[model samples]
Target: MTEIIDYGRFADRLAAPRPRWDLLREFQDEWGYTVPAGVDPWPKWSESEHHAYVRALHEEWTGEEEDPFQGVDRTLPVPKALDEWWDLPFNSFTYSPRLYWTNPEYPLTLRPDPSGYGVSEGLPEPNPFVEPGGDLRLCCFMAEYEYCNEWAYLASEAGHDDPRVLASVGEDGWVLQARSISEFFVLLAAVRLPSHFGWSVQLGDDDFPDGPPVRERIEAAYRPMGFQNWRELGADTALFGGPDVIVRHDTGMADFAVEISGRSRDALAATARTLGWTWDEDLVEPPRKDEESQ
Candidate 1:
């Protein structure tokens, strides 16, 4: 039987060393950044409570279900250095599922066997000591990985194991994606924007010099809508905000193509007018007509 530990107290001690990651601000500054309306800040679950929840999960696995927790040498020990992680409120700018760890709607428990990354699902069988095999130590319930059990964000229990690594138990074998939690953040921040959003950039050229006129107009278009990708519109054309952005140079001001709906589009268009740029509402018309002919 695993003994319950004081997770909250441990988290307090660990908080001192954890990096002060302002993920929200970083996400907002990136181009094509968007978040849902009901965003709550971090520390969603208290450490003591969440650890109790995890222990309960272990009980469920070991009780009647077939002892999924059996024979794994690597136990999910509360690490002295990483107790702060359990207290973090998981929030991704675009994706909502990252926040589902404590969400009542999704449920907090993880099921093994076919539904999870288990031996039946291409993972290696369990061993006496926890080896990098079988299901990844479930960190949080990501909606993206709900269906697939191949890969997940894993926090190794043993101090000898990679402190924080993304482990994958695929058809090939167990592979680690990120070497450390710091490396994982870099990977998470670099995820591509979803296809639904349109991307384009405005630039000042001979026709529209990079001056107050251009800046003010861009502001009028972008600022009022609360679109916070201002760094992309900064003085330098060379710097790219992200993949979902358009970049323009010093010869002519190019029109922006936005995928937002209704009044937002109107506002952006109105702002473009300040720089003498026209919004071609009919640009998509020709393509639609062609598709209709087909």
Candidate 2:
């Protein structure tokens, strides 16, 4: 497996190596699960955990412990680049990227996402970018929305070794989401990790009406990760990092939207205080003393 690019500091929070990975390899040795490459994406679950996870899923649908990947056919040659993206593990159960890894052959084995767009509707097909009647194959990797799945992210099924990323915005048609699958993954991480992990605040144009002054304040509070590709917004998307979290500033179609996050309450408080944003959420709340905790 090749080293995953940070992609302007987007992927490090999601795909960076962790000390827990060593313990995961030990579990694989004990359970006979394939010990993934050192550089491969981290496993979302342990072998035993996955077995139970699969069983629960089967019980939900089949009321039986049937193998989902049974008799699956691999008609399309899976690209090495895509395989790497597929191997990376991330939380998907709720409004996140819940990856599908089963058999019974999901068509060309590319609809690895549970989105209705890929499995049920197959709405964006044959590649609209290609000339009419020209051959085009797409691999839908993920679909997400605030609630139901209404968007799709796909790539070329049989083209470029590391396919460029595409997105289907319901009826909005397809747009170039990223230059490569790796960049797409990091972009997803950059947006998702901040809101999901530390204490976060989402700001609007009012807060970031001016650019340089706001950026200078943020830069003073955190280290810069770098800008990433988010063409959907039609502007630059930059990310910054504190000791353990990320702050993303998006200047796109909707104008400026900045999210500041930190690993701990103290850190988040410090950041929010420095920015003079004391809205009195956990970000600014000091930890209670032991006696106050009761």
Candidate 3:
């Protein structure tokens, strides 16, 4: 059986510095959770503000005349430290076909917190994709990307026997990252809060120093295909051979070129063609004169 890690004890772990992934995995295994794929760095807001915003959303979604949070104790049973964290923006794993409810007449009125990535749940209609449970409701959403945005939520079952769950609704319900909303913030922060907090993923050890130097290559080869940050697309695939290191684009564009560098044209070309991308024969720098002389 997976051992249950006490929430307070986990907070102690977060009090220390360490790799985000390591801490996240530890939490997941101990708490029986998993997070979404990508990260969104939203800004922070006060707890009252968050609750107010969500209540407003519920009002908007249901077109209700009454206040949703009025006289209602929709409080979560989590550590006081975690509760305090709800003020920060929502930083969650990515979701596809980004979901956002825009009010053209008053879009800015219900705008996300200062970081511009806060998610608020107000819709009375439950997401059909998510299985019906104890008062499952949308919490907030990440920035929109690839036609959709990832959203987080709270369920009644959350914090009961199960840890508070903050999940995203996709084709498949991603319940893996379910933890008290406080835990969600703590996990992300423990790893490393994004500089933009609500705009991007935090940089782990692998992203720094010299891990996958695919960004420059992507700009050179696949920028036209709407390729942007490495975190957004994650690592597609890495090829090692003539070009030394070749990175493929995961930008969902068929014509994106394979990144290339090195003098081995024939080998690189063969590999590119086999992989179904047009090859850049000129990618290889000319062999150095000293090497040529050898």
Model 2: what TM-score?
0.49
lDDT of 1 by residue, 1-294 (tens): 022222113223223453534532333233234445455443433222333465478668878443333323334443332343333353342234342222210112232332333321222456322475544444432212232222233334334323443333334343444444433333333332211222222332333554555544433333221111211111111111211222222221213323221112333343345456545554321111111111
Off by over 4 Å in 2: 1-75, 88-137, 145-159, 170-172, 207-238, 251-256, 282-294
Residue 212, candidate 3: alpha-carbon lDDT: 43
Model 3 stretches with alpha carbons more than 4 Å out: 1-81, 86-154, 157-162, 178-183, 190-294
For candidate 3, give the lDDT of residue 57.
78
The TM-scores of all predictions, comma-separated, are 0.35, 0.49, 0.28
The residue ranges of model 1 lying beyond 4 angstroms of the native Cα positions read: 1-25, 32-75, 78-90, 93-95, 98-144, 152-157, 160-162, 192-294
- Give the Cα lDDT of each candidate: 0.32, 0.45, 0.32
Cα lDDT over the full model 1: 0.32
Better model by lDDT: candidate 2 vs candidate 3: 2
Better of 1 and 2 by lDDT: 2
Candidate 3 structure quality by residue, lDDT tens digits, 130-223: 4554354433422223313332444333244323433333333333343344444343332222111111111122222343444453433332
lDDT value, candidate 3, whole model = 0.32
* Model 3 residue 199 CA deviation in Å: 16
